[model samples]
Target: MTTPKPRHLETPTETTERERCEQWTDQLFRTSPMVRFMAKHLSLLDCNPLSPFPSASASSSSTSCSSCSSTNPAPAPASAPGQQPKLVIAPCPPSIAGGFSPSLPNEPTSHSSILLCSNRIFSKSHLEDTLSHEMVHWFDHCRFLVDWSNLRHHACSEIRAASLSGDCGFAREFKRRNYAFKLQHQNCVKRRAVLSILANPACNGDKQKAERTVDEVFESCFGDTRPFDEVNNPRLNFKATDEAVY
Candidate 1:
């Protein structure tokens, strides 16, 4: 028998949340049907941290579509009718640092573009989180064009995308960030109400209810389960509000 060659092992490198998010986005398009659909209509461009990739390159320029290049020509159009949408992925220009902005009407030529920015300025999770957010924007824009109201529905869509992107952990992080913002705003009553609802055993699916209930009871009895005094102190015009308010 011929000797089998040993498989090469790649070393793992530490990555920030933003880098992780970009990776997750790449993986998502590769696997998710809905994501793949969106990817077709919307180009996901990776922004170069080193040099500025002008919006001009994204719009006015007509480079060959990344998905249609010889090495990876677009797959046979999905069974569904209509022409398959095309997508392009490229490095983001250096000028726009924190995040990529979705195309705006003023920049009509830039429509159907998704900017992927450098991760140095944001947590790796933010890159993925923002991409998911932008994808929802694209879906809305595709269906509604320029209707401003369509963006309102994006919050829920973003949540679903982020969850499905294998970045459900971002949900918890989002809640934490929101909580901190609320605290900073001195919205204690609202914060407590929100926390109570999040702490509810029933919200996390019925299957998890039993375990969550036990955990809640244990925390109530032994842990500092009470909301922060600044947030729920009865002396400061605080009153126990309906949990549903959250």
Candidate 2:
């Protein structure tokens, strides 16, 4: 008689649990190439959320700005060549309220030449998340080089950025730090869903509609929960990965 292979030692449930944990760990460690690529593009803008603008003479580029005298300078150049051109941040015009709008929230209409916003509020860690979120919008606008005429297109761009943000290790870290602040100030359920949508590559479509579905799923699990402070949070301690869970 032929010898039979020995039976597996582990029970089915144990094996399944082990597999699930492995999958989770894999996700936790996965790195997103897309996020890295986009970050490469972002580095070109050279805007530092932490500091005020530096003088025009200090910048490497040809562009000059009257506002740089008052604002913080950008962080060291992080962008790659052949990427989107950088913009100068300047003071807002009196005509605009709150000194900015989501459409062009960074600078005043008078200084229309700048590509990125230099405003202090946009640079705050939490606000940087918003700015990063908006930059994704601008990135799409640049990529298509046309108006996002359809709802599907808008949804696609947001989804793309969100997915990239989740997988992009640096972007995710930036988001986590920024989000930590918001979590301290207000309910994080909605914010978490927004972050989830940004981090998840699967949620793109019909912007408003997609948001509703995302919101539902988040509420079901988090239920208006506030995240622990970033200093003490366990989830933040994990390394970034392609398969990482948020």
Candidate 3:
């Protein structure tokens, strides 16, 4: 069976949400301290909501290497490659947007990525939190820190995102419900991490691989916290630059 592709959001309401996303993404690179600090290698670009997703860079054979035969796939250099240049912000179908990686499927993503999203359901603050989560993934990819093919790598990133971002915050959770007793944040992070990891079909359709991978990396990834000690707010201050912010 052919997998259904993500539908592009185009309704009147969706258009407004898309406009808001573009503004927020631009603001993030400009003001977000954590994002700017971590994303030194990446260059922020002007994005058009109507523009198509950034095309994948083609790996053309190096004609410069006269020593190798033209037919042979040029041997990959030993050194690690550079980070994907820009983080794209695009609108995706409701099913895939908000929480999914704009990274290409089944790929660790050596090239650029899309920040596929819509602000219809989530607030501006919520959107920033989500962007920060993806940015962590971008940090890992750019630095060649992990083998993206490995399920454990993905699981570890998810764990870090949940633990680092306010995704598992007590205030966000208890906003509606008046729970008598306070709950531990770790439990929330763990549960959210599992759900995210298991969402990947590449991790084997919500079965053993995804769960086990999370379990194996849970201690290490959850324990390995950075940019924050443990669940502190990471809001950024946006400064106006030469380019006008919408």
Off by over 4 Å in 3: 1-9, 41-85, 99-110, 119-121, 175-183, 207-209, 227-231, 236-246
Q: Write the per-residue lDDT of candidate 1 for residues 1-246, one digit (tens) a residue.
A: 011111122123212333343455545445444344334443322211111234222221111211332222223222122221222222334433222234456644334445454333244344444454455445444433433323223222332233233223324446556435433322322222233334334344333443343333332222221111112211212322222111
TM-score of each: 0.32, 0.28, 0.62
| Predicted candidate 2 versus true structure: per-residue lDDT over 34-77, tens digit per residue | 22222334333332221223322232222222222212232323
lDDT of 3 by residue, 11-102 (tens): 67756665676566555545556544434322222221112234433211110111212222211121122212233334556654444333
How much lDDT does each candidate structure score? 0.33, 0.32, 0.50
For lDDT, the strongest prediction is: 3
Against the true structure, candidate 2 reaches a TM-score of 0.28
Off by over 4 Å in 2: 1-37, 41-85, 92-116, 119-123, 138-147, 159-246
lDDT of 2: 0.32
Q: Every model's Cα RMSD, please? A: 19.0, 23.0, 12.3
The candidate with the higher TM-score, 1 or 3, is 3
List where candidate 1 sits over 4 angstroms from the true fold: 1-25, 32-34, 40-110, 120-126, 147-171, 174-246
**Candidate with best TM-score:** 3
